[model samples]
Target: MSSYRIIGLFALLGGLTACERPTPPLAAGQEPAYDLTSYLQEQTARLQQEQPPVLKSVITKGQPTETLQLEELDWEKELAIFQEVDLSRPALRDFYREERHTLPNGSTVSIFTKDAEAAAPVDRLQLTVSPLQKLERLEAVVLEENLLFYSKRNISLTAEPGSGNLNGYRVEGVQKLIFGDSLRYRVDANL
Candidate 1:
C-alpha cells in the first residue's frame, strides 16, 4: 500500500479505538473534593440537630436466610456523574420502606417495615420506593469495615461468599451498613 493509504488506515483504527465522554467541567473556582466520609459525617450531624427523628441508632437481628432470596438487581448507563439534586428531574412524590423476598420454592413475600432493622442474613431488606417523579437512583452502604456506594438500579447483591474480593457484596465481616435514604442495618452471618 502507498504511504498515504497506510497512514489513513492507521488513523481509522485509532479513531475506532478511542472512547470519548462529554463530562462537564468542574466549577470554575472550586477544586475536586474526595473526602466523602467527612462530608457524610457533617450531614449526619446536621440531621441529628435539625431533624433528630429522621436519624436513628439501630441494631437489628436477621431472622433466617434459609428461605429468603438475597439478590440485587442492577441497571446503569455510562453517563457523567450527577447527584439526586443535580439538574431537573421528577420530584419524588411518595416514598415508603418495605422488605420483599422470594423463597426457594418460588413464593414471594412483602412486608412494610416501619424501620429497617440491622438484622440477620435471612432478610434482604429493601426500600419500597415510589418516587413521585422519575429520576436517576442511587444506593450507599456504610459497612463496619468500609463504606461503599453504587448507583441504583445497577448495583446487584449476591450471597455472602465464604470469602471473596470486593468484586461483589460479601456478608462476612460486615456488621453495619447504610443503604438508601439513611436506612441503616446489620447483616448476621448464621442465617
Candidate 2:
C-alpha cells in the first residue's frame, strides 16, 4: 500500500479505538470534592438501621393533592419498593457511568447515567454532595432523546443517603411511572 493510504487506514483504526474507551469523570490532575460512591454506601446502611415513618404524598402539576401515612406499608416492604426504583445499591450502580464536577461554592455533583439500557426512559441519576460529603440534593431524569415512542413505565426514587448529624439520616422515596394507556403515577414518600 502507498504511504498515504496506510496512514489513512491507521487513522480510521485509531478513531474506532477511541470510541471504545469510556471517558473519565475528572479532568487531569483533578479530584472529586466528595467521595460520592462511598457516601451512597454509607447512606444505604443508615437507612437500613431503623424504620422511620414514611409520609406518602401524591402531587399533580407540582402541587400535592393527596397525602397518606405509609406506615401501613411497613419499612421492609417500603424499602423493597424503593429498591425497585432507586438503584443506589453498589451492585446495581455498576451498570451506571459516573461523572463528577466541582461547583463554585465548593460542593461536588456526581452524576450516574445508565445509558446502556435503551428501553428505560428515566436512567440518569445525579447527587449533589456538600464539601463535607453531605448529600444535599438528588435528582433523576428521563432524557428526552431516550424516550420510547410507545408507552414506558419509568419509576424513580430520590433519597438523601447519609447526613452528618446527631439526628441520623432520612429516607425519601419517589415513584413515577407510566402504565398502560399512557397513565402516569407520581408518588413521593419521606421515611
Candidate 3:
C-alpha cells in the first residue's frame, strides 16, 4: 500500500477511537442554555469517525438531518368530523417506501416502510408521519385537493424553486433540517 493510504487509514482509526466526547460542564447555579447546534456538530463527527473508512457510504447514514421536527396539529380528532371520509377510510394513508435495512440478525433486509399522512376532519392541518426507517420525500394533500409543506429535509439532491427545486436533505436530530430554504421548490426525481 502507498504511504498516503496507510496514513489515511491510521488517521481514520484515530478519529474513530477518540470520539467519546465528555459532556460539557454546566455553570454553577446557572442553568446552561440548550445548544442544538453544538450537539449536532458533535454527533456528525462521531458518526463519521465510527464508520469504517471504505467506499464512503456502505454504512447507513441513518435519517436525514436527525433533526427535521414535525409540526403538530390537533388533526385526528378533527379528521373524525369529516363527513365524506369513511371511518374505514384510514384518515392516514400508508404508501410503500422501499429501503434496505440492517436487521438485528446480521442481515440486510430490503423492505417497504409505511408512509402515512393524516389530518383532522375539521381543523384541517395535515401531518405526515413516516417510519423512521426508510422515510423519504414526505408530502401531503388534503381531500386530494389542498397541498401544503410543513417541513422537509435532505438537500444533497437538487432543489429548484420557481426555477430550481430542493435536492438532497439532511437532518441532525429531532430538532432541525440541516438545509432550510423555504422560498419555493421543484425537485429532480432522478436521484
- Winning model by lDDT: 2
The count of residue-pair clashes in candidate 1 stands at 14
TM for every model, in the order presented, reads 0.20, 0.47, 0.16
What local lDDT score does residue 122 receive in model 2, on the 0 to 100 scale? 46
Model 2 lDDT per residue over 153-174, tens place: 3333444435542122223333
Rate residue 87 of model 1 by lDDT: 14
**Ten-residue region with minimum lDDT total, candidate 2:** 165-174
Which residue pairs collide in model 2, if any? none
lDDT ranking, best first:
2, 3, 1
Backbone clashes counted, model 3:
37
Model 1 misplacement above 4 A: 1-9, 16-19, 35-185, 188-191
Cand. 1 Cα-lDDT:
0.28
Runs in model 3 with CA error above 4 Å? Answer: 1-32, 52-148, 151-191
Residue-level error in angstroms, candidate 3, position 96: 37
- Candidate 1 local lDDT, residue 7: 100
Reference-based TM-score, model 1? 0.20
Runs of candidate 2 with Cα error greater than 4 angstroms are 1-45, 59-65, 72-99, 112-122, 142-180
- Local distance difference test, per candidate? 0.28, 0.53, 0.30
